[model samples]
Target: MTDGEPIPEERGAPHRGAVWGAAAWSAGVLVLLVALPWAARHRLPDPLATHWGGHDPDGSMSPTGAALFPAGTWLVLVLATAALHRFGRRAATGRARGATGAALAAGGVLLTGAQASIVHANLDHARWQDADPVGTAVAAVVAASALAGLLTWLAARPRGATPAGPRPTPGAPVMAVPPGEQVVWLSRVVNPWLQLTAAVLGVCAMGGLLAPASGLIALNWSLVVPFASTSVIVLACSSVRARVTARGLHLGFGPFGWPARRWSPADLESARAEQRGPAQAGGWGYRINGLGTTVMLRRGTCLVVRNRRGAEFAVSLDDAERGAALLNSLIARSDRTAVTHGDDHR
Candidate 1:
């Protein structure tokens, strides 16, 4: 087993232990959101204050509505994430799982905190409008939600993510560049599964962005902004283009290729073609597991590179052999040039 490879336990989707843990955690969160408000029903006003405008209450819902609203939203969120875990291209990956867990954790906290605040404010009030200002409580709730999300993300990160990988392969394929010849290799890969996921998120974001006009839900910029931003990011990462030239490897991302990464030949320790899969690379898209950073679109042949620090970076693509060969050749050429310069100076 190489240093960066996934162990037997890390290869598959939806581990049994993880499933049960998530279910239990979800149940706990649901209970907190529902039970707290219901338990305090006797003290709260018949119609509880829900939406606050500035310092005063501006919107209200029945005691039953108040209890069920946040809980219902939480339930929907849980179900959506559950579907994603079961069906998403790389949802089972450590990074994906951690992201899902973190979102749920933060959402659970926000829902439960809001419910608790509402119940507390409405206590001993004759009317929903008379409820005390909950600005401080709202701030506290947001802080707690953020903290919980961060903690969950940190806890779920893959353990022992050391920057170690397979040793440099001397037998790896290489291409020879003629003395004055210009060689450039271009390769691109697109993940339809990721594109589909991004499209779905984009549709949802569009709906959320327009929901305010519909007057169906109390949808606001706070919810729409993050959702839309996420959609854009996912769409941007759905496709990747790799270009190898005398300058080194240039990776362009998305259709427009706005965000890209470049690595000079001198910066790479070694380049090789390695057979890998989502199971081995810890799921799809961009990932960093024990295997280091992998821009894994689909699994199979990957152009893997190790920097001087022994840190590995990989990208799954077709004709990876040619790409790796060209990269390795460039590195070799750069090394020869450096050695020649050194000898001249001496």
Candidate 2:
């Protein structure tokens, strides 16, 4: 590397390999899962279905298995594929490798669980359920445990070093900055857990409505409202702007949605980033409380500021410590400028 010479970007082949490998593995797993019940149905006598108390007296697979298994398997496989893409972007390190492996394993287990849930929920409906029920159940448990173990192993591996210094320590107070400098920051709304939960719930609700026993026409409406509302909220937070100027602070999110909130700079006092646990922080989203208002998801850093009225305004940002530092500098400068002008007037 020489001064003025552009450094060559590292190729992404290995990461790509990992991603593709994970995808292939997940696909194979899904295929095996689907094939198992079919094979068992053929091998065992139909009397086993009756013995197992399946809802289907004729030893036929339940509709639930057909629907949920494929859906869940596909969802997990997609997530694993995405994770592999992310993993490939980072330079390979022990930690990165571990994380990648763990993510893949978790994806597999979750995929399996999706299949198992489908089977378990409709066990009563399965005909010719197979003679060795205990053995089959044990195998499923062992497979689940193996998947979990792999994920744990990967998660526990050390992370690769970055050219950048260690990520800002979580919960550290942001350093202050001087006023009059324009600062920009980016935030993303990527909450897998929330999205997954909502999706599963929505799917279940839809399935219930379509089932023969369904009497609650209104149940589907209940499902649609929350599903739609969450989708809107998530979409809105995908991209947002928080600008601090002499006039005031402007906060806007989503491409076309309305701005969530805004406040005058005069009303803004000190700003700091705080690390809050999920339990304390209310699980993600724009949250307000006596201490102040905060926007966060899971466990990450957030920028919190005090208004002139002593109320706090907090926003979740990637690289939150840096954002908080920038905000602090701006507020300190403003305070000093105000004091200097007051002294001169006196």
- TM-score per candidate, in order? 0.50, 0.42
Top candidate on TM-score is 1
Clash pairs, candidate 1, are none
Instruction: Flag regions of model 1 displaced more than 4 Å.
Output: 1-172, 214-219
Q: Per-residue CA lDDT of candidate 1, range 1-346, in tens?
A: 2223443323322244345546755776676667666766777778888989989999999987886888889999999889998889465566777788789878977877777677777777889999888899899889988997897686555432212223334455787667766666667676766655654554455445333322223568877777678867876677677778788888878645649999999999888888898888778788899989998888788889888899999998666777788788889999999999999999
Mark the regions of model 2 whose C-alpha exceeds 4 Å error after superposition.
Answer: 1-181, 187-190, 201-223, 230-259, 282-284, 316-318, 335-346
Task: For residues 113-179, write the lDDT of model 2, one tens digit per residue.
Answer: 4444434433443334432233344356567657665744642344211112244455544443333
